[model samples]
Target: MALNSKDTAETLILLLNRSGQGDRAAFAALYQATSAKLFGLALRILHRRDLAEEAIQDVYVKIWHHAPSYRADKAAVMTWMTTITRNRCLDLLRSLPPEHGLNEEQSFDEWASDDLGPLEKATSNSEARALLQCMKQLAPLQRQAIALSYFQGMAHEQLARQLVQPIGTVKTWIRRGLQVLRSCMGAL
Candidate 1:
């Protein structure tokens, strides 16, 4: 039950090394040390505890199965594990429908209910927040296009069809919308 502090660095390294070499006990220790934090991260993005927990379980399962594929020099164990968790979350998002799927425009407000507690505020950079605010300023159509393209896995043609617009119009809106968002975001 050691926290992942500097004091546990050596122990973590030992566990990672052993886990890489097929040691189940060391792998279990690694999961115990990091699952909570990883699940918290997933919950932040996915906004569902059950989904987050399932994602966390899937992530660790993959980690155990793929320990030997990890490269220590390429990333710290936590970073690698986080990447795995993020990919799993994205995959799950992709598999879902828009409301169920990754709709960037889907406000967290909809997900908030009496049962859900306040979301922990992530320490985002001021610049990033400003940029997000600027994106929020776009016309609803333009914003929808961008959100659909970036978050909903929709291609330009797909978005155009969905929006009942011409392909060129969708492309133009995305380009113009991005430029405006960038300039506005940068100024903030």
Candidate 2:
């Protein structure tokens, strides 16, 4: 029988709770169930298979370490995991040389295929589209600053260095961009 999104989410929560208690079997099951989707997310962000794989490993390690602290109220289990994976990939990206990191772009269409199940994909696609639309509404520099800070997980100093702007200017751009995004998303 197939599980719906609620069922799947419930199962993941159970597994996460068990994993929090150091249940190896539950952790393994969670890994088996979610790794592909998480890997796809990492690959989308980093645009490299090897780096994505490394990010997945690092993400899982952090997940294992941090499981006991999981709060269902804070975010859904999958959302939390995806956040960790994305951040790991961004960290990897930051560590790379600028020439290799900023210049690479691979087709994400192939990376997403069959990785996220149907319902998950549908939900993700809608959310991604909404975010893209809101991003497009920003001024070019504000959009760029926000993307680098949030999507790429760059610090203000890093963004300043990369964009050749002052740190305060980078911070202002990110702050104003986020405020605009919040207003835009709130209207949706």
Candidate 3:
């Protein structure tokens, strides 16, 4: 049977719960369902195929261990997993050596994009599409600020310096942009 959003979330919850009990099959199923989206998110932030691969692997190991702690009321499965992936990528990026390609001068170009290519590949869910739609409506700078802060994991001070704007301005852009997103999302 085809699964709606509710059904899909329920299945994921079941899989997570089972995996917490050390069910390898359910864990495998969960990984199969989520790894692409999670990997895409990692790749977007890390900007290296190898690092993204490493991050995905590490995130799943944590997921396998923390599956029991997942509280459905706190977040949906995808949101929870995405949080873990984002955090892991940030951690990996932070610990990278100067020999690695990462540096303070790295461009904010990736975060500034509204391309739905990654999202399209990740999921065709209505909510995902709606978010993309809302994101499209944001001013480019607002999008850039939000993306850099969220995905690239830059602090307000860092973003201000990187963008050559005042710190308050950077914070304002992010706050206002998030407001717009929340309003737009609620409307949808």
Candidate 4:
């Protein structure tokens, strides 16, 4: 890893250690340093902005409770944080009914305000930017279907109902979109 990456990891470790001791300022600093990336990850997993926000909030709560158990020898601080966030998102997805669909009228701007600020976008790691670029290469409908299924954890039937498309069509869109994304990402 680069020197800067090492420094960042060390800083996160220090923050985690302080947070484990119940240092509010350190915990706050940790959130400030990591929330944007974690939020983006949650949003990618749970397409609904509201749900993503909730997931990140829950993730931080878990971090607060579990920070003392973190083992740097097992994984880097960011890896541990990401694992927690990802697991939280998966748990949330599993808890929701497969038929649940997001409200179509909820504006993206509302959910993206804090998560995608200028600095956050500018600071996003290259891998995230590349994945986003690959996502952009998808057809509009394909991308929508994929996002609904993967992020929102919607079933094919649910997506069909929300999109006014047949279940088969929704499945096809998701399959093709994912294939394209895989190819694009692999090429990077």
Best by TM-score: 3
lDDT values for all models: 0.69, 0.75, 0.82, 0.75
lDDT-superior candidate, 2 or 3: 3
Q: List per-candidate RMSD values in Å.
A: 7.2, 6.1, 3.3, 6.4
In model 1, what is the error at residue 181, expressed in angstroms? 17
Using all chains and alpha carbons, the TM-scores for the candidates as numbered come to: 0.54, 0.68, 0.83, 0.59
User: Which has the better lDDT: candidate 1, or candidate 2?
Assistant: 2
Distance from true location, Cα of 127 in model 4, Å: 2.2
lDDT of 3: 0.82
Model 1 regions lying over 4 Å from their true place: 1-10, 101-188
How displaced is residue 27 in candidate 3, in Å?
0.5
**Local error of candidate 1 at 103, Å?**
8.7
Off by over 4 Å in 2: 1-7, 97-99, 104-125, 157-169
Model 3 is weakest, by summed lDDT over 10 consecutive residues, at: 101-110
Q: Which candidate is the best by lDDT?
A: 3
* Candidate 3 lDDT by residue in tens digits, 1-188: 22238988899999999999899999999998888888888987888999999999999999999998888788888888999999999998778874654465556554465575664465567776778778877877777777777777889987887788999988888888889998999987
Per-residue lDDT of candidate 2, residues 14-96 (tens digit): 99989999999999999999997888778767877898888899999999999999987788888899888877888788788
Relative to the unseen true structure, what is the C-alpha lDDT of residue 149 in candidate 2, on a scale of 0 to 100? 60
lDDT of 4 by residue, 61-170 (tens): 99999988888788888888888898889788778886543554532232223233442365446565677677667766666676565555568987788778898988
**Candidate 3's TM-score:** 0.83
